[model samples]
Target chain A: MANSKRTLAALVYNRPGVLNRVASLFRRRGFNIESIAVGRTDDPKLSRMTIVVIGDNATVEQVRKQLDKIVDVVKIIDITGDDMVSRELALVRVKATTATRAEIVQMVNIFRGAIIDVGSNTLVIEVTGDEDKIDSLLNLLRSYGIREVARTGRVAMTRGGTIGSIKAEEEAATGRQR
Target chain B: MKLSGARMLCQALINEGVDVIFGFPGGSVLPLYDVLPEFQGLRHILVRHEQGAAHAADGYARATGKVGVCLATSGPGATNLVTGIANAHLDSSPVVAITGQVARAFIGKDAFQEVDITGITLPITKHNYLIMNASDIGSVVKEAFHLARTGRPGPVLLDIPRDVFVEEAEFNYPDKVELTGYKPIHQGHPAQIKRAAELINSSECPVIIAGRGIIISDACEQLRELVEKSQIPVATTLLGMGGFPGTHVLSLGMLGMHGTAYANMAIQNSDLVICLGSRFDDRATGKVSAFAPAAKIVHVDIDAAEIGKNVRVDVPIVGDLKVVLQVLNTLVNSKSRPAWLEQIQKYQREHPLCVSSEEDKLLPQHVISQIYELTGGDATIVTGVGQNQMWCAQHFLYTRPKTLISSGGLGTMGFELPAAIGAKVGCPKETVWCIAGDGGFQMTMQELATAVQDKVAVKIAILNNGYLGMVRQWQELFYDKRYVGTPLWSPDFVKIAEAYGIPACRVKNKKDVSAAITTALSYDGSYLIDFMVEPEENVYPMVPPGASLAELMEHPDARRANASSTFTVSNV
Candidate 1:
């Protein structure tokens, strides 16, 4: 079976050791986690985590079911095959000289990347996009001698109207009646 | 009113309906031990080792469908409970292990006797908690018990700091837990149930593989009803022994590696396999690709992750076994297959499980059969790993649920003595027996002192073969007659039992076996009987590792022909 990348988002209770529980579950099951990002959600008591894993459809389904077994997990959504948008933040430092600086700036502008930091011989570029877009930009800048790179794995959400938007519409109707 | 953390913990346990606890105290648990005496509602049994404490609790839980409790201190003491915890996890036994940690201030400072217990037990435990504050003790205890006992029960651990035990906190136990993520599916899908019923009705040759889940869900009556209604022959996993009455006409005994030859053949020949609550472990399914190859499997389990894990199922119903079996009984129509039953009978007659009475030496099977005859298949039998476990599973008949307690999944060697102690404690009125081999008996025989001191009337039956029989059987079959480290040197079990202040006897002849058991049963306290049987006798009908269930070595003569030159060339 061909392995494909999957993005799963989970809403969990904000408590101590929740992250460890999720991470250890993956480690124990021998599932390699590509990337994981966690942050507090709109609800103060709940936190949302985005995990990028590489496996077949069946393996990913098993992971979702196993995650649902955890007491601290509130909900899990596999947004991989859904109509969704994903973004990854990457900061890359490239060796730039007076001669290559202008060309690098033009390449960054083409990709809509921002120059976050400038040292005497290095320029730190911040890029946010889907994995392919980031990879393309990184590839274009490799000739300038890439010094270092750091990426905040992929975070994703459904593209159009979701459950949150449906709730908002219900609240709006009640507000009009009031 | 304010109460110390230890007192609050004791109160929480009492509130959860806990009456007994198995524990071994250490430096980090001193504060809890000091306050333990005040709680008269809870009785504590001091075990010889932390491992024994854990296994005893596990056995108690298996005997009774309640959460068994065990306590230990930090570091080495907590680490000693690892094997027991893993055993309970694998078997889905409800056990709550409480470990005392270093004081709060010394938690991360590499304090003496401080080990990351929760971290060590992360994979084995269903869930674990580290209590940093005394105020959360009540709710944590409540949650731990609820988690350990509810839907697909498993082991849970709670590590408390020493300072937390001494600190004062207001005790307010929670009335109900609100866990959003841990909802277990109890009701099966109506469509799936209908599909399963259709498959069961249409199939001419059908077999039911009942597993530990039937016992865990307390669905023995539902299972028996379903089997009798459908007229499907039932084969139980090792842990599922008592779920269906072994003496029933349609019962095919245990299935898998060391299972009955007829049972394994019936499964292989069946057109439909209705798996209830039992995950098809590698031991149960000889070779994954060839196991029940022609059968369309209907698997029902509470845990969704277990579905399609090892074997693909045609109709998968994720729900509690009791509810699923209840609904299934109503949906399934009455039917019978005389041809299939006749075929199984033919298999049974062709390769019957029998020992020749003409042999002068006493066989291990005779000992088990004698025990069964003496107890009328009513005693709660607990066994350690290896040949003794397989022999007991084969020869003894279990008529009631929770009657056979053994470490099935983890295969812990030293489980018999401590677990039997726990089993006796759980059901004081019933007769409990620990059937162990010489190798495994020595591993945890130290717990005999605990049994004598506590006055637990658990009969000890040691099948002393002088060698690690199961491994020796393998060596005899596969590794050319060389024994290697399989042979053992041991102390006299009789003297050992006597030293522990327990009555002891030895039975070397077949005729004396019954008298020894009768004498052991007569004693009100613990008693040990060392039954010296033929060391070279092997368990037959073994499906060699990686072999298909269809290919089983039926007897020693059959093995000798296929075995290397070693067995055939050597003296019989």
Candidate 2:
């Protein structure tokens, strides 16, 4: 259910209860809210939420309508139905010693990820990119030995314009009225 | 102002409220046993084997939520508890197994009757301690109880060397316990509760799945209120049999491999599934890919790891079930969908469980219901694995938690008799019944002496079919009746119970049943009543092993359709 191409951008008042309302909508629908990134979107009074959700076209449309009804949500968008630029961050630690450490570092550089930290026997690498790029890098880094991994999942924005920034400002104006 | 280490151990145990302990003595534990005589109000059952002692403790723990305590001497005495300890560990039973070690001077010197019990049990226990000093005994014992009873409660071990028990010390038993690394978070975030409520309100069709956690957390009342107020139907796991009474309008009996068809259908068709304290076990979900395929799931549990471990949850709230359910109950509006409920009720009526025909010579359901009638649904019913276990669970009417005791997680055979002894001891006022199959009876039948010696006075009802009933039934259904190594020539159980100084009766015809049960229950001493049930009889309404709930097979009995099959079969 989490395997979906639709992306939704939600604007909410900068408060504690907004995330709950959004998550509850997806939970009640049995659809995995794949990736939800919430932060102040260039406005102090409001937060922008980018949600990557998986569902059919009808379900996606239903989710947007449902989110619009929630009190905290100022607006909802179906960005996947439009063009978008998506990026995600991941941190992976691989087992390494002097024996195979150099070979692994070279692979990390090729993936455009940085060697964040190093211990006597472990190397921690941080990478950020689209889902496909992250998957390819993980595949390339599996040879040296992956010990543990944590991913930030996917968060996206509209491409070729400051659409998310404008939407954030517009939602904040109406959020204060309620 | 001085105190002996032995006296300190007794004082610590009293402080921990250990009313009963099961143990066997040897050279190393002799001092502690000697001190036991001086401690008032604490009764210890001297079991034949240390293994039996450990199992008795486990049974006591499982029967009552309290931490069960057991003791043994060094080497063989301590080692005998391995099987029971492993059993307790696998089932997540709270047990504090105390074993003695050789004197401190003899430690690691290959001393006689010395074994590294703590090292041996490390992998099995949640945590273990080796007390080398007499001064530390009281505190360590206190900590052991604390650890065993809190946070996914599991068995803990304490092995003390003999010298520590004999040595003198200035004992100061602490009234309060403080552990740094062992705090379990109970209250969930307010935001999480609000979100869960929001999800429930928005869902068009929502079903609540409750588990043993509701009982463990003492949240059944709140959970019931939530489901009722929200107009949601509730399905429970096997361990959660009586969490919400099966008679409730919203109660959708047990759901799983052998679950009632309606409960499974309720989950499968629901638009949203709200799960409380239930781990989506393979049995509960059948094949995870097809389980509740239509629903979005919101999972609430105390353990974080359990979330998304089985069925992926859209909203995972890590908190106490009782707390979350109470919050949701208050927030959600009460609205019933009669149409949705009607659909489920149709499934319940159409796929009702099938009891064997009245004409059948020996059906287990009849035997169980007869036992229930004789005991008046108030006695504690314990069971061993396979057909007898399922039959007892299905037919027996239980009104209270812990009243129906069986090995749910491990499904261990040979658990009935010894466990019944433990249950009887735990609740001396209640009539305790052990319903076991022939195969499971002999495994720990030697413990019959414990009942006779302890004068527990519990009754043992043996469903003597001369075969491993459950496995044989499975072979009959799926394995083309190959019956490999399942058949056996049974011994005279009546004579065996008689040998232990307990009264015994045998029933080969239907008329002998009532008299046998009457004699067993009325007798002042322990009694064993053996009923030779039909060998070919099987537990019906079975969901074929590894099959989904939708694929449950009803019994071949035609009378079951009318629900008029009186539980009457020959007891002779």
Candidate 3:
């Protein structure tokens, strides 16, 4: 069977060794991660990490169970196939000539990409999309001599609502009340 | 000798033999962070969340059979540890969780960043303390560890206020702890032991049910000796999986939901039931009045409260399992095997609770049986919650204590991986197999790397059924199969395990089980085996909720209509 991966967005407290502890837990339990995006949450006290992992039903549940036990975690959500606005931002520097620049610009406009910076012979373009879209766009840009690419793994939210942050705050409020 | 309460607390933990602590730092605990550098020998792991810290500590405790420690600051930090603490309490794991509070002056004042951790965790922990005085800190710290590790091991919390840390106090550490309400009976009365043996000798057919207490008491050897001397067959609760090696002639595997047909049949047929170190959990006893209807019961346990808490006991002996077993073993005369064994064996052959067959595609039983076959009845197996744990108790042959690590009393789903890590750490040479369902494994999946990083070499087997299998079963049988909130669409496991540098495999058919097991067995580092099995299969021989044991719905093929109304089967 063809194998695939899933990503998880973990909202956790920003503290020392939090990443190591979470990483170590994943290593010990044997869950596999494809990519991880960690940055600041709305509250400066907490940090958010988007983890893309691969597992069958059993593997995913195992990850959920273990993650639930983590004390620093405010909330954990799996947005693998749910209806959601999922995007990753990547900056790629590709070699370009005047002849290629017009074509590149057309391709960028087609995918709604932005030309962030232009070097003498290299153009740094920023694109945001689902993982598959990014992969395809990267593939198209590869032919133009791709130099270096820095991609944000993934950041996701359910299409119509704000569930993660709200649930986390509710839990915090309930915890305080207790 | 000025110190933050957090620093002194860390020093106290170090004194208590705590080598590692899992927690998160926050506004309420910044003072401790500043002084953390001085505690050079103590290793602190900052968890991504407070809840993870609690679970890691619980995992550490279950694995090593020692007290695990977790820490967090006030409010949300303390609250995050609640689930982990509750999980430990359910599983009877020994863990210590310490959290910072707002200054004691503001305890009930609703100070900024303040939360009443003690009040919230009271029901979950064995004991909890709110430290208002710096002088009381030394004693409270000592008491927390003592309470957590003693008696029926469980989590204990110590909530330290911010001001207490900076205050000066005499460095007096009491040499002992004394609690009036906490006296645990460790030795059974001689008269009671004699009476228990007398009942055993006189009964036409007697059966023994052992639980985790045997393992906790380190009395597996004694239990084996007693079982052999008396020629009594033994059945265990889910937590008691490794308490008796299932290879013994008298071992009747697990009893109760998803239990062996023979074990439940034996319980039904016996005249006298001798229960040791095991509580009569609703899952085990199944409709109390209907359970062991013909049997006169003798219950032995260290916890007095557990006695008569579930099932009525003819005789209750409260004490340490080892001491009680030793006394009982010496008192009971060497007796011949009861004819009941023959009848149970006949039932075993007739009903035989085997889950694998050519007729079914990939079943959970097939994968479990293959793992059992490959291990050859010698490996230590750990389980997470739900059907997978019941399956191990039913199928895997447990030969010794610590062999089958599971969160039984607490039924915490994510316990297997961390427990297996601790077990491997305690016994490095022994192979530890962690078996879990999709729901259970995900609870503590974060601990996977700890196994790899520590070179724990634990093997993981995931039985994937694409749902919260256990709850889904309950919903199907009792709640009209609405199947609300149970569906699980999963990601491919192989690629994920590989990313963390662990060997991984996926098995979708029965034919692939052996190969998957072989690959996991041979891999030098940690390995993950994902076995995709049939969903919608419920654990049978179920005594419908609130129904008596006699009212069990046994064998779907032989399910009696109106089974919950009576003990007798008219047709049979």
Candidate 4:
């Protein structure tokens, strides 16, 4: 089967070396990670990680299982091809001449992006959207010579309220349930 | 209470119920050595080398089902433990390795005797930690033990800087670990268990391939119940020898590359393969494309990654084998397949493993059989990697769980002696035997001093063939009899044992083998016996690499004569 993109969110303990544990697993398994983003969750002790990978269903399922094996990982949910809200933040620095600045700003405005910084011959545009919208915006700015691009890989959650909160609560209810 | 980091480490180990540790002291771990005398509860076995310490700990863990502890210093000390750590990891042995690093300030400066021990061990360990502060010692130690012993047990590492050991801090051990991500699933899904049961009950030809998980999960009884209830034949992986009684009527012995011909035939002909906790390693399943072609495989393992990593599993149940088997035993119906049994008998009759009746010279198989006869297959046999391990696995019968403690997955040579010491220490009353090849015994022979010093009464059996027997067999079979780098020279093992202040003997004749074993068994303390056996002997029923299990060659010449005969007359 052809490989498809898979976006998975994991709630982990906010402890040092936890990220290394997760990252090392992927490196050790030789899994190609497209993008990853980590940030503190609503709970102070918990951190949420969004990881995008490209693989077949079996490969993605294996990645999910391997991630769950890490001691610091709390919960993992795959939101691929589901009714979910997904977004990616990209900071693109384009080589903007005076002639292309107005056109680039109009394109960014149309894509609902913002101008984060302005330089003599460059404009840093910040855009947050699904991968498709971000790709479309970046494609339009590519003609203006994109200097550099930084993206916080896709983060996703189910559209109908919290998907993992109930699971986490049930997991907590069973102390060392094995 | 305020305590130094070294004191905190000792207390934390004590809290985790660690009574003994195998270690070799070095420059970086001097702080730990200095404070070691203060703790009365923990006994330290000083090993000759860092690698010996790790293997000994691994052996202890495999024998006792407890997290074995080993300590080493930084840099070279930590580096030397890599092979043993990897051995434990591959074999699923629970071992906690602690190493001392350079002072905190000099960690990244390439200070003397400093190494990134954590980074070196990251891939091999289940998990690892580098302690920057003394206060974290308790929690780290707790977590390290927890991780090492829990769900698909493996080795864990803890690298502590020297400064952390000297720095004083208030000690508070956490009462509970709150790792949200570390839960191992123990219960099989009800639907999956039912499906497995249905497959088991309905299949006409069912075979069970048991693995090390049976011993690790303490599921031998459950496995036996399921097998007997379902009337399924059982074939064990190398490490899974004692999981099912080898003497049972339904037992097909070890299955794999050098597996019994009958066992391989059973697997090839079965309709359903119930893989309980055994990963279908390449050695076990030669040419996966042609392995068990007629069977629908049902794999039950604790680690989800092992399910479809090698062979595709039809019904995958990810959970503890004990729990899964318990549920399966209830769901399975008691029934017998007379036709299946008759077919297995036919295979067994056609390809019987024959031992030479002529006894002019000693044979390795005779020695193992004599050991089995004398011990009644009750002794815990630990073997170093080689033809000796294969002979022991094929000849000796294991009826008890955790009785055959060999390095299986890693095929690590030099594992038997130190591991025997650890096994003896772990199970003090059991008769522990270290069956090793002459080449492998010489690798860690220095550990004989540790065995004598610790007063561990482990009997040593060296199958002295004067060559790296297994490699010699391969060279003869595959490399056109070019015996390059296979011949070995060794120190007089009897003299070496005597130098260690232990009683020793040598058996050159076939008739003296039993007497020598009896003498070693009757001796009160440690004993070593070097059995001079035939050098040119080779393990048979080997499915050459990448060949189907159905194409097992009983001997090198048989492969050519029977190349086209899939089910023909056996050479034996």
- Model 2 steric clash pairs: A30-B296, B507-B572, B508-B572, B509-B571, B509-B572, B510-B570, B510-B571, B510-B572
Best by lDDT: 1
Q: List where candidate 4 sits over 4 angstroms from the true fold.
A: A165-178, B356-359, B556-572
| Native contacts matched by each model | 0.68, 0.00, 0.00, 0.68
Q: Which 10 successive residues of model 1 chain A have the least lDDT summed?
A: A165-174
Better by lDDT, candidate 4 or 3: 4
- Encode model 1's per-residue lDDT on B247-357: one tens digit a residue: 888888889988888899999999999999899999999999999999999999999989998898999999999998888889899988899889988877555554433
Number of backbone clashes in candidate 3 = 59
lDDT of 3 by residue, B1-572 (tens): 65556666777888888887777898777777777778986767665567767876876676567788888999999998888899888767799998889987887899888987877785577767778777777778888898888887889998888777677776546888744224567889888999999998788788889888887778899998988888888988877777887777788888876666678788888998999888888788877878988899999988765777678789889899999988889888888864777787776655555442334488786677778789786777888888887777666677767677777666777767766765665566888898989887777676776666656688999999999998998899889888999998766767767776788888888788998898888878689999888987666567678775556566564333222323221101
Model 4 scores what on Cα lDDT?
Answer: 0.89
lDDT of each: 0.89, 0.78, 0.77, 0.89
Rank order (by lDDT, best first):
1, 4, 2, 3
Give the C-alpha miss distance for residue A48 in model 3, angstroms.
Answer: 52
For each candidate, what's the DockQ? 0.48, 0.02, 0.01, 0.53
The residue pairs found clashing in candidate 4 are: A73-B181
Candidate 3 at residue B546, lDDT? 78
iRMS of every model, one decimal?
Answer: 5.6, 18.9, 13.6, 2.2
- Among all windows of 10 consecutive residues in model 4 chain B, the one with the lowest summed lDDT is B563-572
TM-scores for all predictions:
0.95, 0.74, 0.70, 0.93
Error of 4 at B272 (Å): 1.3
Q: Which window of ten consecutive residues has the lowest lDDT sum in model 3 chain A?
A: A169-178
